[model samples]
Target: MAQIATAAPGWNRFVGVSRPIAAAILGLLALLMAWGATSDVGRDHVRVATSSSPHFDGLVGDHALYARIAQRVAAGESYYTTAAAEHRAGDYPLRPFVAVRLPTLAHIVAALGEKKAQLILLLIGGAAISAWYRRLRTEPDLPRAAAIGALFVAANLTQLAAREWIFIHEVAAGVLIALALALYRPARPWAAMAIVAAAVAIRETVLPVAMLFGLFALIDRDWRAAAGWLAIGLGFAAGLAAHVAALAAVTTPADAASQGWNGQGGWIAYLSFVQASSLLRFFAGWVGALLVPLALLGWAAWRSRLGLAALSIQLGYAMLLMMFARPANFYWAMLVTPTLFIGLVFAPAALAELARSLRGENAPNRATAV
Candidate 1:
């Protein structure tokens, strides 16, 4: 186990560990990152073909299906009824109700029309970027350069929000998650909590974020925030239950059941999943994979409440993808991709700090909380 670093007399904050332990952990992490960067674990297994354009013919099948469902919903069809029909026609699985996406995004598309819905999503993405810039700028421990890099990466990701991708549930939910994470303020948690609830309504996969928020709130002994997150979780549970029941009502024995999500693809799958979903998708496999660990290291160096929370959430999802997601399920990375590259901004400073620690020097600019 690593020993926690001690703070100075007037300092209230400390970081991961003493220099030696930090060196050992950093070394191991470096080796792991290199191995993952070079390894082609799930490279051969990724189903979608890549292209210069983020949206390619390979990804259009699901988008087309979603579009059809939205059209029906807009034409006065019940969401459950339209979704079941679409699934059966497309030979998509409906056995597990979760396979049928929550009707939230479809409803939004139906109500707003695709063009307007896409506009709203882009606006949300823009807001998330602005919010992130503000959050990073204000973080006491984060270096100025790191904050700018994070903002740049975030702004770049906005370009990936192609209008055609509007129908994809993950795109909207991912932006919303980004917004929620950036919007969170210790003094005013209401907006953040509400945004998380909205994300849950869009994608069931986002439920873990709500739980994570609740856990972090409790750890910080912020009762009101914890209660709000708990309420969102409970509400999501009830909504999910109803969604499941609704699916069952329309489902028949003949409906196709999912083969299963037990991929156990391990680190390869997790890294590959992330590579395919985020801006990393635009880079070569090895180059992108290497960034994964650097980003984590950056977050580790942060040692603030927001940093810890961000790190925990990313790792939690990484574990899930490693254990459960198949190669085709790489898109699930969208759940965490909104803030994924933000860590890259801090990687250089983090590396410098590690060097300082190794030289028996105390790192400065540490903070207790965001």
Candidate 2:
């Protein structure tokens, strides 16, 4: 038998089981990943996002393409005109309708200017930090961890300050999603709902998150919250309908169709995308990717509504990315970035607790809903 590792009292929450069970689950995860990598499908998962291909190759890269559109829109061109022209000229697809970004972000960037828009994004980041701190500070089981929570929020958003990355729609949407998660208080859910609505307006990808919120509210019997979430979904549907109409007016039969998103890229694809989307991208590939699972473990360790919600959202996105995202869609990880890495802060305690359980030590780990 191995010696038991001691877990910090305040951070030790039952991860729904004793440590040995958690260890076994983690072990199984490792084995599955190893087995998955032995196949071409699994190997392909790490390829799209991590390929050494040039990003600004002019003919095929997205960064320069988005920057060009942002510039033209800022110069007073109609979004549809600029978008259609740019996509056609850049050889980007237009047939999927969704391939053309919604006009909300372009119009906002044009009206506010990129710098101001970036500042607003920064403010959203700050709000996420503040909201997370306030929410976690109230948790008696996570003492001294509130500041770390704020730090993680800040860390996840730090990349937003790069002006070069400002135009990526997922950047703003992801941060807003994080803030919404942090702002959610069962007693008063309006603020979070409003923020989610705004995020969905910016990026359609956020729709899934809004639906998750509605599901949680319904499960809790929080009728007001559920209705609010439902309203956001319906409003988004109307907006999308209008968007489709607008697209039809601009799109032509000759416009190119997307190559499609069914990558079936596997877990490596999901983790690679996660690495690209967060600060983890700055680290060595495998090291950065390792944090993805640890962060997931941290989320799993918490027993509260917030923990479960965050874990579910992250997992749902993981499955979507693994099953449907194209290689170039690695940036889709941004859909969960604002809230994903924050779980890393809790991972050490989780591992320690798991170790203790493996050593057959009984710790006074209680489950908390806060």
Candidate 3:
């Protein structure tokens, strides 16, 4: 009997029960919080924003690479030629549908020119932030927690604009994701659906978030919403499949570098980003640190369905980063930074609530007078 009493709590479970599940969630959350704090997001933000004329003239690293890519498109070059030039030093392929990226931003930049495109994106981002902010005046029953999400997203984007991380599709996707969540309502489901679908086009990483919305809708027994999201996911998947087929049809150049471009890396590459000299400076982005907590905290916050979806996107990206997110590929995370910081902004409250629930589940309760 004493041994039984001494046995760990929750050890008597038979089916549909396990202590490891809770432990895993807690562990991941802790790691994310710790890393997000120490990864120097603030430092990186300052550095990027303070860089001299080199950055202004588009003579830096990936910023320059992307700028040059846009210039080539503006000059009427094909995707292959533009991407090929920067990647010649690396083994990256010059294929049409290279996982390196999609052509959404390039197309926009080509049409508008980089400076003009920058101004346009800044305006659109401002409008999105304003739209969500205006909801505070209108949404009466809305909880303060919801407003946290709105402010978080708006602030992150504003920082991006201030720092000139303009027009990256991921930033656009993040804006759309926030807008979708803020405006997601039973009265006007179509608007939310359209925004989320547009995010899928901007960055496929957002597709799972769309699917998670479907799952949440199913749980809420909103079959129409579930069906709409399911259809969106299907269409997004079909588009990706077509892109892959096109990539296969256009063979990589014989002279193209091929060091580790095709989905390569493991624990070594994952941990390498932590080293001072590591080429893949994850914190180079203004909000890289926030990605960790945003993913973890949002996942644990049961009250926020979109938070959970943001967590899913973060986890998916984490796995991809572990495998394929090399130093050169850090730009991948750029697409998701908006959502990451937004999630990070609301993490403290979500974490406190999560802590209370976990303590309630684990602590031995006594019948004390309340």
Per residue, candidate 2 scores C-alpha lDDT tens digits across 100-217 of 8888887887779878989998988888888888887776566554446677678778878987566778888888888889887767889889999999999998898889888888
Q: How close is candidate 3 to the true structure, as a TM-score?
A: 0.63
lDDT of each: 0.74, 0.75, 0.54
Best by lDDT: 2
- Per residue, candidate 1 scores C-alpha lDDT tens digits across 1-370 of 0111222212112232479876886797788788887788446646752222233333456776788789899999999998998777777789877789999999999999978898888888888888888887666544344446456447445634576578778878888888888877666888989998999999988888888878878887999899898888888889989998998899999899987889898877787887777766777778766878877776665666677777888888889998888776777888787787777766655565566667788666543322
Ten-residue region with minimum lDDT total, candidate 1: 1-10
Off by over 4 Å in 2: 1-20, 32-60, 365-370
Candidate 3: regions farther than 4 A off: 1-57, 80-91, 131-149, 162-164, 214-295, 302-304, 343-370
Clash pairs, candidate 2, are none
